[model samples]
Target: MTRSVSALKGQDTQLNCLFQFPPEQTYNRSVWFIHKGKEHESCLTDEPPLHITINYTERFSLAANIKNGSCTLGIRSITISDERRYCFRFYTNENRWTDKGGVTLRVKATPVISELYLKEPPNEGITNNITCKVSNVYPRESLNIALCADIVPKNETLSEQREPDLTFNVIKTVVFTPSKFHHQKYCTCNVTHSALQQPLLKTVIIEFQYNSNIAVGVGITTILLLFIIIIVLLYCYKQTKGKGKAMSMSSTLPTNNAAHSENAVEAPSQESQTEGNIVNEHFEEPGLVYSEVEFSQKEKQNNKPNEDQQMHMTEYSSVAFRKY
Candidate 1:
């Protein structure tokens, strides 16, 4: 059966082969050959000591112990061209053995994924470009690359260049148009190859400027509400001030009316008092006349002396003074 050997480019690899022979028989010579498409080409031969063929460097070596029936071929600094089948053949005096199902060398190079990013900063309603780059890839045909936006596949332009060492460098670019809906969405790149067990991924966020329409609307609404509150407060303040003035006026009206009514009552009482004083003076006039008549009779008696003393009894007097 065929044996498989896996190695990476610029690394060393070995192919191990084993065979069994009887104790009486021993291997005389052995050779290692590599399959070149449809033909076998000898690379190493061991008549007694190992011999490397032309176009092969010391990097290609063979270690063998024929009596023990083991042979191994080592290759250093392997390349993509070294990926092929290797056969080992042995000969003895009795018979010869050539291994047709040989060991296959699979050379691989791990692709390096670069950072995924945008060519320019994103803005709303603007077109942008997203890029993903991969380098150091061997067997370029087996490399697969994909670009996605928010987990959805996107159309991209694939470009590749051959490296100086016969490897590949690839670039994948996709055009992206950003909107408010895609502000926080993600842009991702996925890379897969036969050499990698898991796909490589690089992701970036699609951030952009937001639309100002909604913000402006909200700001206007807030200002309008503030204005309405101010107007209502002013109206309430004016109404309250007006009510205070009306209450003050109403409170003073009753006091003024009561004072006027008291003054009107006191004026009639003062006039009636004056009229009563005049009537009392008119009744006292008779007493004053009787006082004057008594004084005249006293004066006439004094004129007559002792003769008037006998006349004193004839002189009648009623003196009524006004009561103090």
Candidate 2:
């Protein structure tokens, strides 16, 4: 069993003393702490409060505050030379006992993001791997690499080795598939140790796939434009066909009207000619009368005829008489 604390230079830190005892033990108790071969012991007879005297070092300053159920010792700034082991002792009503071992307080330098590589920018429906390397760190187990809001890969593997400067280099790898829901995700690497009250953290920005609104908008706009183009083409085709039909009807109507006008002009002349022949027959004496129509002159008249028939060569007619 081992207890240890890690801290950075110029930072405050604490050693823990959480004592577990039997329920029956009471009335006679004592607690003490030993550091650098010096012991700060308490006496129950004198009613002196339990406390520890620290062997002050060049890196750690005065104690700021004692906290955590009076189990933790607080230090002001810590430095390189302050690295050492601390021991806690206890006594019950029966006898005295010590911890299995002791707490080792390590003064560590701040961790750094030494290297980072993204296999590729996040692509939808595809898995992406992120490799992060942390360097110049001590007590490598305290380093944490995670995604935003506890979205860490369950299978993440952490590996480390020592560097030439005696500091450690830690590597953490994560694998995940990107989604439209995670448009602007952040990946953070953190280190928490006895050196500082707050965890030291570094965050990396990453993103590639577009979110819901942008993706939806682009799809809808494309469909709308295609629909409009099809409608316009159909309208143009209908207009062209309509103009062709109108022109065909207009051309046929004028030829029909002209034929009807020529028939109207010839209709009056035919009626007048039939009426004259009837009058001449009524005025003649009763007899079998016959007449011949010929062109005596070589310069003959051009015939005026209806479109249905033609008058050519010679014509002969017979008149029949009846008693009135």
Candidate 3:
């Protein structure tokens, strides 16, 4: 039977071959590798006796468990250079030998998958993008990449890419419209490859934010604005009140100044008049004399002379006494 084995680097696999011999004899077996008809690697002699070599350099090792002319070769820690066809040949001490079919090793690169995340976290009932990035994938034909969501019944393809290294990458996306109904649903990425034993998966839970926190934030902001307005109004009112008080004080100063000026003028005139009257009354005898007494004691005391007549008499007495 013809068979081929595919594996990733740093993995192990079995290469089994069977043969028939006539009788029990000391048998020597060796596994030889060929790539494109060119000999590249070899494992010579018995079970663990041969050091596995590639390009004449020791690079890998294999162990064979032989029972009843059948062998199972265990290849350990396979590498990319180990990709080739290996065949087993057995030689008996009786000069009987045979070379038979074997396994073709096809080493493939491993697929790398990124985390699944929401494209936009803060979106409403509008559809948002969910994405996962996969890289470094080989054997593109058998690779299966997809996006999965519980809310929707379909898997969507967002994008795909191929690197210059001939390795393909995929960008899978799911268009999801979130509402309050889907507040805690989840999305996942499904990656399956021929080289992987189990499917690689990544998941992200969807979160739909309600406006209660936003409403609370707005309420707090409005209250702060009102408080600031109140403070500004109080400041303006105090400023206006202070200006009004200053204006009133300034206005009253002129009135007080005018009243003081009137009093000053009237005071000096009254003093001069009183002095003149005393001078006129005393000039009649060159001694002390009461100006009011000039009215006379025989006249009506309660009905004394008018103020104009008394003043006239004071002036007349002064002039008359001077003539005397």
Candidate 3 lDDT over 12-50, as tens digits, reads 866666666766677664444442333433332233224
> How many angstroms is residue 28 displaced in model 2 relative to the true structure, after the best TM-score fit?
41
Q: Which parts of model 3 are misplaced by more than 4 Å?
A: 6-8, 18-31, 35-56, 61-74, 88-100, 106-112, 125-127, 135-139, 151-155, 158-168, 176-182, 193-200, 209-324
Please write out the lDDT profile of model 2 over residues 1-324, one tens digit for every residue. 557777676677767667656667652432334444423322222322334434345533323222212335556776555566655555668766566466777777777777776677777767776777877776555566553443445356678898755568888877776676556667776655443468766776677675457679999999999999999999999999999999999989989999876754333233223211112323445654444222323222444444443221112223233444
The superposed Cα distance between candidate 1 and the true structure at residue 247, in angstroms, equals 24
User: How does each model score on TM-score?
Assistant: 0.55, 0.42, 0.44
Ranking the candidates on TM-score from highest down gives 1, 3, 2
Q: What is the lDDT of candidate 3?
A: 0.62
Model 1 lDDT at residue 280: 18
Clashes of 2: 3
**TM-score for model 1?**
0.55
lDDT of 3 at 139: 70
TM-score of 3: 0.44
Q: What would the per-residue lDDT of candidate 1 be over residues 134-215, giving only the tens digit for each residue?
A: 9989889899988764632245688999887888999988876777667777777889998899999888887776446756
List the pairs of residues colliding in candidate 3: none
